[model samples]
Target: MKPLLAWHQSLWQQVLASWQQDHLAHALLLCGPQGMGKAQFARNLAETILCETGQACGKCKACNLFKAETHPDLLQVEIGEKSKIITVDQIRNFIQYCTLTSSYGGYQIAILNPAEAMNNNAANSLLKLLEEPPAKTLIMLISHQPMALNATIRSRCQRLDFSRPDKKLTLAWLQNQLSSTQDAQLLLNLSAQAPLAALSLAQDIKKRGELFQSLNQLVTKKEDPIEIAQQWNKHNPKQILEWMNSWIMDMIRYSLTANSNSINNKDSIKTLQNFAKQFDLQALFKLLDLQTEAYRLITAQTNIKAQGLLETIAIAWHKN
Candidate 1:
């Protein structure tokens, strides 16, 4: 497969030169948030290393091996379906791969996506491989939570941190994908700077509508908060709350700027306008803060009712 469509131009330029010169390191750690395509970047790096006749020309024998899934030098450490943990046994198998001669006499590469999924023994096993890595072997660890990994494992690799693009770029990117004008700022608010989350939200219009409807009712009607929370908890609270937060922010933006494009709801602009006229910016900000804290609080606990969380969110908004 081809590399991801969007390349960080500056980073790609630097990496491409190093690959061409055969000066790249044996281990690289790609750090970024969820859905930021760090794993894809790691895959691209692996393809480049395994490519024959200069790096990443993409049409050589080695590249063909990769495409055919017959490359002797390539291995991947992903989560086990039911276990959800990378085991030491798996790492031991990877160690065996390290000892093999490359089919093309080129470099060997392994991509370990979400390195945090490694259990304690699995991580220590990996450290052993890192200690005496094969001369032609490379390890790429893709991580969203670097802080959760062992310190020694981190020290051995060159870490690359990828950040989210700004709203203007994200909006344009979304607009291009959907072939429709988008509310970038609104999406950004919902996604915590992760554009993929925004794109997902936009695609599920019916779910988004129900989420928005519940949020508006929660804000406007004195409904049972417990029932609301349980409903979202049964489905997906992350996406539901995210969608709610977006509409709430749009309401605030409409109140302050009368900016028509800031709202994500094309069919429910009337509701946005009504909420905008009713709520002030400071109040909206506090409500956002409350909703955010509620999300954090819910995730931190176990066996908690969605209604309780919903009540808490309502209280936060009602007070503000």
Candidate 2:
């Protein structure tokens, strides 16, 4: 298996130590933001527990099985391909799987990724499994939003937080992963400082630049909000909203601090500063509120029209 990221290594060692002492929790909730390597950590932990030497020794039969993706004692649960939520039936299946004996005569492991994707019924079903966990079984619940889970479910498991890593460490690691010259700091900023996410955003940096141009045109009243909204409707609503949020927040930041270094959109510092000067703090905050609401509505997959939402936000920028 691949090694854990540098930020994850310390936590890996802590869990390893716990497992070595045979004191690892039966159900562990790996809580963190997306792209923090929580899923990888859970898989590594499962492999370690299942391996013969409890070290994830690749030469061992259990390790080989895991690598081959045929580990009988392991179960991975996630939302179905066509579905947004993990159904109760899926939770029940995993519960049944956990009840069986470990084929390797060792740990029986189940990994529920993005555990918040479980609907109420599915969460309730999983709660029963947590309440009376089977012997020598490990249930790993991975969640980007832990608070969205049932309180009782959260209370039952030991939670391991994978919060943001050290800035220097994260930047260094991210810089090395880039194939070309890209500002690791900027990528980090755009991704909320998540390294893997920063890396993923590298591909979209050019697209972001294009979007920023459109935003500037709208803010300067050089472009029609309706036309821009129609153009933006072709893109991913969530990502479009995220980029807009960042730009509007930078405007707010510049408006308050008047420090270019404090803003995320360093490439557009002059534009943000110029725009910030035109709007009072309250107007900027209102614009931010509109953008934030659009973001929330899109993320929640509400029935609201994306184009109209974008148009409203665009018009706010144009009118402000």
Candidate 3:
């Protein structure tokens, strides 16, 4: 809530220093994957920009209003089931706020989480503001895929990319998180090397355990791979994709180097170890791509059924 998290310090600094000086842009596009803390960073940036005395001074009056979730100058726009775009109506309302003199007499900030969610009309309306940005106004547009946005919209703003942290860094950060709560190895299993992602996974312990168990059973006892994948995918497509990814990576790692560092499935790696022995490089990468493609399709709007996903994994799992 204080606008700081272990995995995002570099991002904090980059935006801060740029704004602290005169070089910060009126509009910034924040690019990162889903649940990777881009929204958090945008909130922190908003707080930092509106801080009365200095960057992110938590004790300031404006900061207090923000923490209380009633800041007059800070605006957050997100998509809902109600309408697709930020909606032309929503953007018009926001423009009214942006054009007004800031109540804080500093930067008035608006954050559009997943700016790519905007439809063409909504985006074009925002383009007008970006083209003629108000004085002391800052806009932070958070996106998972910058390519989804209009190129003209992208061209008007500074771009910042949030990348996945390395494994060692992720572990250290996880340890820090574990000190305060019950989020332990579960996040590591869910996110791989992304801290915020792992943290997100900690919220649902039972589902995670079930997903892990299903995959473990598939590897350990040689169940019907398609049936198992279908059952798991029916529960959560994303979880199935992530676990399948970790599954193939383990196979690839074990096949290539016999290294077990990447395998979170200590119970299942023995099975992978054996699979690695029978499978060669071509076979392994082919299996890897199978799951990788499934994950990509699942992440997109592809309408493949769970059985379809299962069959793909089954074929790839036994690829020769």
Candidate 4:
């Protein structure tokens, strides 16, 4: 496996130690927020376990097959492009894969990312496999929201929690990755301190700035709700709503405490302050509630009418 991120070194050591001691769990749940690199870590562990040398030696047959994405012993199950849920069929196939011996006489590995994306039947099918895991098999379940998974499923696996990392180390690492100077702290705050998420936001600064500008125009009555909604709906609706949600939260924080430091969007502090002056606290709270509901609705149903929901949010902003 390639070297893990610095923050993951300690956990990697712990997991590697377990493997060396022959005490590694057959199933592991890697739980953390999105963009913390849990998926990458799980993949690395899988490679290590599957390699004949018990290390991810790039020259080894197993490593070569894994790098080519054709390793018979490695199975990765996730939601399909057209579907939000991992179906029972996928789980059934995974179970079948687990039942077989490894072709390389090494560990058979299965990685299920965003494990909560499994529907009830699919999860139940997986639960059965967990209940009677085959020997020399390892199942790595990566979850951004582990609480959404069934308690039984969670309990069945040994968990590797990746919830926290030292902020100073993360910021230093993020700064090194950028070619130009950037407000690493602001990006970190925007991403709830998830380093990879912060990096993604930093890379897309222009798009985020445009979204903030559009939101500002809506607040100033310079843009029509329907028109803005139409434009935003052309992009990712969920991301647009998430930005709006954060803005509303900032407005609320500034309104209550009059502290600019409390705001996540440091670049938009002045605009948020102006917005706070114009909109009442009640209206901001209502907008927040609406955004939360919109997020839930959009996430629950792929066919949801996001334009309508965005329009509703825009109208509310105009009204307030």
Report how far off residue 315 is in candidate 2 (Å): 2.5
Task: Give the clashing residue pairs of candidate 2, or none.
Answer: none
Report the lDDT tens digits of candidate 2 across residue range 1-320: 67878898777888889888988899999997887888888888888888888788899999999999998999999876546677788889999999898887887999998899888888888888899999999999999999999999999999898876777888889989996568888888878788988888898888888888887888789999999988888888889888888888888888788899878877788888988887899989998898889887776653667988888888888886
Compare candidates 2 and 4 on TM-score and give the better one.
4
Residue range 111-136, candidate 3, lDDT tens digits = 88778877788889889999999998
In the range 1-320, model 4's lDDT, one tens digit per residue, is: 77788788889999999999999999999998887889999988888888878788888888899899999999999888867777788888988999999887877889998899898998899899999999999999999999999999999999999888778788889988886668888888888788999898887888778888888888888988899888888888878888889999999999999999878888888888999889889999999999999999888786788888888988998887
lDDT of 2 at 63: 92
What is the number of backbone collisions in each predicted candidate, taken in the order shown?
Answer: 2, 0, 0, 0
* Total backbone clashes of candidate 3, pairs 3 or more residues apart or in separate chains: 0
For all candidates in order, the CA lDDT equals 0.71, 0.86, 0.74, 0.88
RMSD of every prediction: 5.4, 2.3, 4.8, 1.4
Q: Higher-TM-score candidate among 1 and 4?
A: 4
| Winner by lDDT | 4
Clashing pairs in 3: none
Candidate 1, residues 1-320, lDDT tens digits: the string is 46453534456667778767877777888886675667767777778777775565768887787788777778988876545567778778877887777767777888887788787888888898888888888888888889989999999888777665544666666667764465655655555566676677667766777766766766676556566666667666656666667777778778777888777655678888887766678778877887787676555444545566666775554343
Candidate 1 global Cα RMSD: 5.4
- In angstroms, how far off is 42's CA in candidate 3? 2.1
